[model samples]
Target: MIRFFTTIGGFLLGSLLITLLLIFALNPSFLAKQVLSYGAKSFGVPSTNKVDKFLDQTIIDGAIDSPLALTYLGLDSLNFLTGHKSKLGDYSLEKSESDYEENLKQLNYLSRFNQNDMPEGNYNLQIKRFSLDNDIRGYESFRYHSSPVTQFFGAHLSLVEFLTDQHKVNNERDIQFYFDRINEVPRVIDEIIGFLDKRAESGIYSPEFVYIKAMGQIDTLSTGRIEEHPLYETLEKKIDEINLSKNKRENYLGDTKDLIREVFIPAYRRLFNTLESQSKNAREMVGVWGLPNGNDYYKHRLRIYTTTDYSADEIHNIGLKMVSEIQNEIRSILESEGYDISRPLPELYEVLNSEERFYYEDSDEGREQILADYTKIQNEAMKKMPDYFNELPKSEVIVKRVPVYSEQSAAGGYYQSPALDGSRPGVFYANLYDIRATKKFGMPALSFHEAIPGHHFQNALNIENSTQTLWKKFGYGTSAYGEGWALYAERLAIEIGLVEDPYELIGSLQSELFRAVRLVIDTGMHSKEWTRERAIDYMIKNVGSEESEAISEVERYIVWPGQACAYMIGRIKIMELREKARNELGDDFDIKDFHSAVLMNGSLPLTVLESVIEDYIAESKT
Candidate 1:
């Protein structure tokens, strides 16, 4: 229930999971409509073939077990799925272990049907099998290292992020569902702590810095000020917005305050205490390499995130090469503009960042302007989508600031997918914790990467794809595929004339340089055993990164190994594929068709994505 959206959820839980399993049982006509929605008419229909049916069942089972995902999909809007609204499902290590065991059984069952004859079946069966197998391997190998609590993402932050942003209330029944969810926090935190205890038994625990940061976050949240807590504020606001009597509204607010004080605040304190104890046993090293079987764990992470068999050494070298090349490109741009090239790289960056025009005032008004400018940038980008994409999503993307309380450790920017029922538009969350950290030059690249033609574009298209099954349209996992596409989107803007200023062009290249430097620094810290300070220094010197930004990025790589490598590695593969397509197809290759080949399949393993593009080339040649 907690990790219902990660790569683990993709494989062990079956990336093919689609909660629409009940469609055929409840309404055949409706099922037919869904199946025919996009004309191929195969994915939405449950196959009569036993092999296909078995695959469908595994995916459906995983979805059913995740009430949190169901709610995110707006399943609560459906009469059939609303049962999940009042539950958080199981959020324990015991549950994950059992789920892993069940996946093993499911994998074995799948092999039994491989030789079965059928006229029709899943065309992407090999990819599906590969994904599930990969999931099983990671689950067996790295479960201890893959703690549910990290500074980057964990129950400590996710509970607040999800409840405030994702959970919605419209009526009294919805309000009741909200309260039922509030009452589930204690059990979830206890379950998370139980998992932490098990991980500690294996000598795997958060670094002291991480646990300290987590403890601070928990303390901020669990301050016992019910009136001020985001949970109370959000729900109370919802209660007031709904068409309810004054007495009913007061009763709801009073009940919510009780839940916050009695259930939530206490649960957070328990979580805080657990993390406090873990810090004492925490390892001193920054990398997972310091843990039991840490070397193999890092390898597993690279394979999953990059979706390729790239060794740490190979990735490290790639990073070094790209970093040098990108820095030259940046210098050429700045030097042409008559800036001194003799200064240190960080000094150059310092000058660029110091420009008064590049930053807004460090005030509330400035933060609001950042959000507004981001929206305007995204809106303008939408104008060009029709020329680049044959199929554009109907779902709109919106810009918002990261919630005030949790922005400290949050990434500078990120995207959240829309609610499946169209109740929510996709959101691009810019971290405005420090208004000074967000410079104007970086806005265009960040906007494109996290919003238009980046995450929002790909994700919304996935949701709107009539031909894909519920699984493909929902949560097919692979970080490289998604992050790579977004990274590529940043450069695509420069290619297509979206970067309107010389400084903006520098921002785009600097962003690319940042990702490239990640490859070197991430592998350096995790594989070469570089210290945290060493990695931070490398980023600053190489990428001309702000010290605070460098520190944040380095620490992020510490907790989430292999993820930082995904952006550059992914973008490289995508660019290579585009060139490959263009070279072979000659005049036959259309950019729009190439995009369709890359994106229409939803997030894919780089290997699988290559195969898909190759097929597109072959079809075009005919």
Candidate 2:
């Protein structure tokens, strides 16, 4: 009897193993999707709502992981304990190789998945797959240059700041968590150093200028002055706000100070030393154009961001054509304003730069004035948006100066996505490092792009749409779609009469020209092997931006290849669809309804977005 029972059990176990193997072999993507579905269902989100919910959850998850995300969310300090830390360091050639392999595998798996198997309404999945594929290709291209200077290694942006921002010291447990993490920072730095050393051996390194700037930041961070230390200020403020016992609060604060001085400061100092040592070997040329497979990498970046495969030469030609068209418009504006048509574009740029009405002296007062001006622009833009777009977001928008420490490397402006719960407003962070750079004429278009009809409108609507899953609403966004939309918004403002001043219109043209030049410079450096100086010189001549600003922009492109191409590529696609809709529907076309269709699905691959618009145009005609 015992022998018979054992034989039966063995047979059942063998049958179960075969079935499991068959399921895994049949469809790994299906299995993964099933796991994801199970996880989503556990959160009370149905499979149908997977796209939206996935977006929201991913956004929240990213926030949980990224310090920069926390800062953007207005959180005081990041909760790093909740996020996973990367084991790979700057020099981990082995890890880099492994990462590349893993990326390729993931990409292959995604490419094999049938998009048709996804629910029709679940556009987010398709978008996600496209995004993932883009990342994999990007990783594969730049796997050789595993240096910290690159955006991939610029992990500092999301890592340190995110943790320090949302760190709450309200309770004993919270204080302990802060201390515990603070204590571990040295280990993290050590890991980073080890990674960097590995990278150095592989001949991948940052430029001297980058290290010098990075060291200066480290010095500022490690000086241990409470007033200057953003981390200390955050902790003290949190303690003051909460109902913690005085003794416990004092103890926590003391411990925190000790940790900062001993662990955090030391770690930063070590990192600074490592950077200083490596600075000597750093290259003067800034771009991935010199890296292995640089051309292929850049092409992949362009495809991922723009969701198209237009060649660099084609993009460059388009930029030149657009620049000519915009120049003609500027000439009309100049003629209208009684300015000389013969004045050179560069001369005009210089004149515009020096105009007192267009600039404010660099000061705190000037920063406040800019913010106030931004608010005024927002209100005016809001009044005009109803003419163009029907789906206006209910969320409020605010403009603030970029944090003092980060402002130097930051862009002229950036948009922060609205919170999941709608408790906080969307933000447009303007870098007021140089008040002159923040020209008044650019304010109107900037407001429209960063707030109102731009990021704030699109992002808030994504979050607020009841039909979308959390993932679909707040998941990772395509840089092309997001930046392209913002760029497109600038043009839309002009159409609605927001850029009344010729100089303002000039500013708009300059902005568009800047993006166009990016295609040439980005591809030139990464693919054509143009030196950093070549890229910068070309930018100064064509874009008419300040040399310093041009250099920073070039460096950004180098570190983040093909990303700059998204604006023009995305804008063109959007415009093409809009024109197509207009032609098909003729007088029946509703601008509001058109915008609703574009934004209602949230951010999507350009191809998917085009199909959506095409369908909407057909529906409207009926």
Candidate 3:
């Protein structure tokens, strides 16, 4: 959910940079562009320097441009930058263009330094330089091929979540900041509406599915009464919990209600109207293949997500092969357990899901038990990590049920990283809306994947690490590394004896099979030209997923493009490298050491990761 925090920085005048950061709260762009394209000689600071002050300045300056990012990263509390907490961020097309140009200049600025001459010890420099070299590809080749208000990442919907979840209202200043940000909604909405219209004018309309989902979400925002709305009600509840007097609380509520009526509601309505107007012209286009030069865009997204240049057909073939191998393995296990091998996958899943022993009751108590079980599983997983990981993250992880309101749209499970400053622990959300997704047998692997030994562990390590710069902790393409790490964690549990039960082992395999299936589904929709229904049907028949789960997963792949492929591709690379190290080291090979080398550096492209592994092996041999 975190956007990439670019640092347009170099070692230079500290006073000038500090002045720019202070002024950025009011006009971030002009000074930001100046800071980004500043004197080139400053970048000549030794590349081997682990504590690159220039790079730190770049991240801080770039982050200053995005007010919402500060709140997410917990940097809003910093004394020098607190003025931005009240502001929303720029979503104007002009800003997008400026960002694209800034990236180009950043690349040029990076070229002034000596990438090849960089110290072997400073992997951060290598990773950042490598990332910047590729950051502009997606922006340059397919800028108009994507939209902000889509089914997955709609700005209108995100605005609500950001305010309710991220915007902390602690004192009088924060309370006013909350209302002040609300006051900026109309401007933000106007920019989004304008961007949508402008994109549509260029034949870049979102598909029927995208706009329809967005309009429905907007309806949720626009249709509710002012007081009953989640935004207002949440504020009322928060205000009540705090030490404010009754009169002050009433005034607060009154001010918020007035803002909702005059500013928030009308802005959402305008957004809704725009989406409705656009939906009429929306094509049934499901894939990027429908856009102008879409095949190239899909390839670019593949590079962006997977960090590998594997073509669509190659990925499709890999998915096919993996599906066959995994299904055979699943059949072998079922046969050993005396289950009928002749039955279909969906029927097998039905039998498994129907076991009342695996599920809780359909009541509030059942929901609470499910959450408790998840928490138990997470706690257990965290305990075993010290033997495997050399550096255990101090930050803890907690399991929480998805809020009833947003659970409808939530995935089965996901991890939110800890705050960069360690003020917040990582969170793993289990959506109990669908009880089938919370099957007891799957808890271990799911817990391992979403919490301990997965996202929380890896992300917390990145956030807590003293050596890595801010960009490494919060950069783009971390998802490629992260999703892979989480997926790999599912299998890692089996090796570490976390999945000792026979059924739980099947659960682990099933989780992997789901990712393997994703590889095929993603490539099928984008490259093989499979319709949405075809992809959903394939999953239902192959993985025995419920139709609803299959539909949601397929829709996610449609919107995200090549992201689903990252899990398997990255795991394959990591596994391949591990095997190479193991074979070379033989008796000397240590799983703990191998893991340290992988996790110690911040997330990297698979290719760069392979380089890191090679260096580790060579060092070990010496």
Candidate 4:
């Protein structure tokens, strides 16, 4: 009887093992999850213990399904494990719809787990819920005139930039992956063209001006020779660093050139032709106000970007009020400096802008100096962190210039977070495309906003925090939460004595003023049907921005509705919360604690943020 029992146990165990092997073979994602779990455990992240398993599995599946998201997260192994050896994911509309449904499915599965049962569940739940809700809403509701290509910052521009900057090329395998992506560019372009054609068929189109810019951008890409192309040149630069033989190097270069010329350039030329022909049907009107159900669309945008229920008129009024107060403060500062306050602000800006001392030389040396000064500003802000921040990011933030190709359309400066593995530091890309246009006074505040105690602090902390799940760390937060904190950091620098010079102080105020003007102009164009010129004029008259700068900003607003409004709206809420905390806690209020409370839970909606602050206040009172 004992021998018979032993034989049965052995048979059952072998059968179970074989079944699991078959499952792993059939479902690669299951095997991928097991591999990811081991990797996560090596990094001290728990995957099998509790609710975190849900998060780890979600991130694994998400990265496998989306190549761009995968690249941004610095995860490459899963792409190969999932049989996507050399290509990004499909960009077709059918793929997009299927992905949307999959997200909804995951969301449903996630909702079944009770968030209250876990230690850090609320933060994870809120971030995931907010992300999924917004994506679903945008995908389902906002498809009328939405095309895949945008002259300013869509897949067309961002993909090439991503390949150059974010995609790693460390070894022969990585190089082959790079080649595969480049070779796939034509198919991607064709997919986008299909979407554009669908929009055209639906009587929806990008504005005529968008077509003009898109064609110009495409022309810039097409007219350039393959040898001088950004794609080709970046690969040439990367290949020289690899220790490959001469024959291999030549072959790699040849492959890259063929991909750029035969595959990439022709695809762009095709896009250019498509846009040129489509422009004949495109309207002159720029805003969504002219599109089908435009009002509802604009309202959805306001709610989505600001994460608030505020109306267009109310936001407009808030912008107007803030502008008046900020301008008055500027006037008082100028009066104390013995400048004539009688002249209009724009004329004053013209005079101050002409001063040689206020700007660097329009040369390479001057651009390097701007970067150096920004570093200094970042260092100075770091010195003041102990006073207001209880926790700071472990990662460093480096300053860099925006890529030359996209600099014309890129904003002044933006922050990219460090890799999760700590291989790369966070980068702040300042637009030094036109060195003369870069302002010395503006550099200080920009540094503070984009680097230390701003985006770098908020994002890196969120990414590094072990308490939150993997999804919360990797998931993209709302524009309002991220942008609002950065803007508030600009003001905090002034409070902490970083902006001591009058000019630097003015630069900070001007930054605030710029966001305020965005509130007015963004709403003005999208909701009130203000002409593009009228919006640009409003920015110039109020904020004293240059014509080219105003035009770029207005065009950006035209393409990205309600995004510009988030900064001021978010800043105002953060300020209000701080004041309420201070008022309630009085002498007991700790700035560092207040900041940690705001940041400890990662980004949250304004409504959720208010409740968190109130909870902090109550806990402090006890």
Candidates in order, TM-scores: namely 0.91, 0.82, 0.90, 0.93
What pairs collide in candidate 3? 7-58, 7-59, 8-58, 10-54
Model 2 stretches astray by more than 4 angstroms: 1-45, 49-113, 119-126, 139-141, 144-153, 168-175, 243-250, 474-476
TM-score of 3: 0.90
What tens digits encode model 3's per-residue C-alpha lDDT throughout 1-622? 1132233333334546767667776765555445433421232232235335556556656776788877887766442434667789898989988987887777676666675555665555566666666567766767777788865666787788788877887787788989999999999999998888887898877668877777777777777678788789878877876789989998999999899888998998998898888888886768889888899989988887888889999998998999888888888888888899899867887888778898888888999998898888877887788888888888888887765545555578777887766677888888887777677887888888899898887888777776655455545455567788888888898998888887888888888888889989999989888998899899988876767677768888888899999999988888899899999999989988998888867888888888889999999999
Clashing pairs in 1: none
Any runs in candidate 4 off by more than 4 Å, and if so which?
1-21, 37-56, 83-85, 103-131
Q: For candidate 4, write residues 567-611 as lDDT tens digits.
A: 999999999999999999999999998898878776787877887
Query: How displaced is residue 134 in candidate 2, in Å?
Result: 3.0
Give per-residue CA lDDT, model 2, range 391-468, as digits (tens): 778788888777676667667788777664456678898878766677777777778788878888888887667655
Model 3 / residue 147 / CA error / Å:
1.7
lDDT (0 to 1) per candidate:
0.81, 0.70, 0.78, 0.81
Any residue pairs clashing in model 4, and if so which? none
Q: After superposition, how far is residue 416 of candidate 3 from its true place, in Å?
A: 1.2
State in Å the error of residue 212, model 2.
2.4
Each prediction's number of clashing residue pairs: 0, 34, 4, 0
Among the numbered candidates, top TM-score falls to: 4
The sequence of per-residue lDDT tens digits that candidate 1 reaches over residues 1-622 is 4466567646555444444556556654355433323332333443456655555555555555677876786656443433667777687877887978887887776676553353432344555666777789888888788778877788878887778877878789888888888888899999999989888888787777888887888899999567999999998888788768989988989998898898999999998998988889888888888887889989988988998899999999999999889998889988999999898777888788778998888888988899999999998898998888888878898998887787887889999998766889999999988776788988999999999899988888887777655455543677899999999999998888899799899989989998999999999999999999899888888876667777777889999999989999899999999999999999898989998888887678888788778888998999
lDDT: worst 10-residue window of model 1: 34-43
